[model samples]
Target: MATHLITGAGSGIGAIVAERLAERGDELWLLARSAKRAAELRERFPAAHTLVGDLADPGKLSWAFGHQSLPVELDSLVHVAGVVELGPVGETPVKVWQETLAVNVVAPAELTRLLLPQLRLARGHVVFVNSGAGLTAHAEWGSYAASKFGVRALADALRAEEHAAGVRVTSVYPGRTATPMQRKVHQQEGVAYDPERWIAPESVATAILTAIDLPRDAEITEITVRPGR
Candidate 1:
């Protein structure tokens, strides 16, 4: 079975992706911020290795990965952890911008750097769970859009740099999804939460799985999933 590491596996798209991988009998390493949620995942998927720590903290992330006795080879790494703080550029808090970039861009970049050796050994695939905001910036989504744009840049650069190394990089830009974070966004916008109006997290997970399942000769460099209006 292929070994995969997934970030933000405690909930939302990450959790659904983790479940799909587990169903395929892949060995999984799950990184989650919540200890309670990590414990629950451990119970549900007893074979998974759950790491609890904040992705924004480089030191904590390093410590967690360093302590784990993972194999020298990894088949896949899926980055799904992110934070959204919506506001006009003038009104947005500096701290929110910092946190958003840290989690959405910096953390994934650092983790990928750390795992490069392992990935190269396996000629692994790296998937970045980006967003539609990465493509277009909305009025109140400057900070989030900026971070996602960084994600797109990172994936593009990585794909180009690692092509010779046989490491595939894909960025999946999913539109607004039915997730807890979406609910919060809806609340912030004073709109009712209608799941039907959003894309399902599982659908995104399926797209990711398709990328992972592709032959080594072919690479799905980027995928954009939009809600069917």
Candidate 2:
């Protein structure tokens, strides 16, 4: 079975993706923020492996991973974890911007750098679960949008650089999925959340699966998923 490493696998789209991969009998390495979270994930996916490292502090990830055992080679590395804080640019604080970028962009970039050797060894794929905000920023989406845009740029550059090495990179930008993150966004906007109104997290998970499961002869560089409703 192919081996995959994934972050943000604790809930929503990430959880669904992890479940699907497990069902397919693929080897999974799930990244958790701490020992407690890792234990929780192991309980969630009994057969999967767990790695503990906090995405909130990207600077310490390398140090953290040095103390853990990583997969020797990964068929795919999927980044799905992210944090968001909403406020007008004039009202947004530096800490919010710093934390948002740290988790959403910097940590993913750092993880990719640290795992490049393993990814290269497997001629693997890297998938970034980006957001529609990465393409267009709204009134209170400044920091989160900036981070997603940075991640999109990172994916593009990595794809170009890794082409000769047989590594594939894809960015899946999903619009308003029915995830906990979406619910939180609605709360931040002071709006009621109706899970039925948005795209289901499973749909987004399917899109992610499609990218990674495609035949190696061709690659899906980027895909955008919108609500059917």
Candidate 3:
């Protein structure tokens, strides 16, 4: 069975992905920011491993990716950990902007950097769970959009860098998903954004699994899933 490493595995799309992987009998390493959530998932999937570390911290993420004594190497790396900082551009705080980039951009790039060796060993796949915001711009979403744009750019570069080495990178850009991040975006903006009625986490998870399970010779660079409604 393939061994998959998923960040932001504590909830929503991440949680759904983890569940589907486990159901498929794949070995899993679920990374999250909360010990409680990790522990709960561990209990739910006894065979899966859990690590609670803040991706925003390079040192912490580094340790979780490599320093931990593991009997198995990861065959797939899915970066689902990201933040959405929404506010009018002029009112958005510098710290919040930095934090959003830290998780959405820096963490994925660094984690991919560290895990590439392992992925190369297994001829594995890398998945980036980015946002449509990464592809399109909007008002009051400058920081979040910038970070996701960085994510899109990073995935593009990594795919090129590792293509010859048999490591494939796929970026999944979903629009207005019903995840906590979307709820927060709407709450902070004080608006009614009901795009969630169409963009389900399970559908995105299915698409990601399909991408990862594709033949090594088939490289699906990027896919955009928008809410039907």
RMSD (Å) per prediction: 1.3, 0.6, 1.8
Per-residue lDDT tens digits for candidate 3, residues 95-199, read 998898888898888877877778988988999998889899899889999998999999999988898889989999988788887788788878887754759
- Candidate 1's displacement at residue 176, Å, is 0.9
lDDT computed for candidate 1: 0.90
Residue-level lDDT for 193 in candidate 2: 99
Q: Per model, state how many residue pairs clash.
A: 0, 0, 0
C-alpha displacement of 228 in model 3, angstroms? 1.4
Task: Give a tens-digit lDDT track for model 2, residues 1-229.
Answer: 9999999999999999999999999999999999999999999999999999999998999999999899999999999999989999999999999999999999999999999999999999999999999989998899999999999999999999999999999999999999899899999999999999999999999999999999999999999998889
lDDT of 2 at 80: 96
The weakest ten consecutive residues by lDDT in model 1 span 63-72
Model 2: CA > 4 A from native? none
Comparison by lDDT, 1 against 3, better one: 1
TM-scores, one per candidate: 0.95, 0.99, 0.93
The alpha-carbon deviation from the true structure for residue 72 of candidate 1, after best TM-score superposition, in angstroms, is 2.3
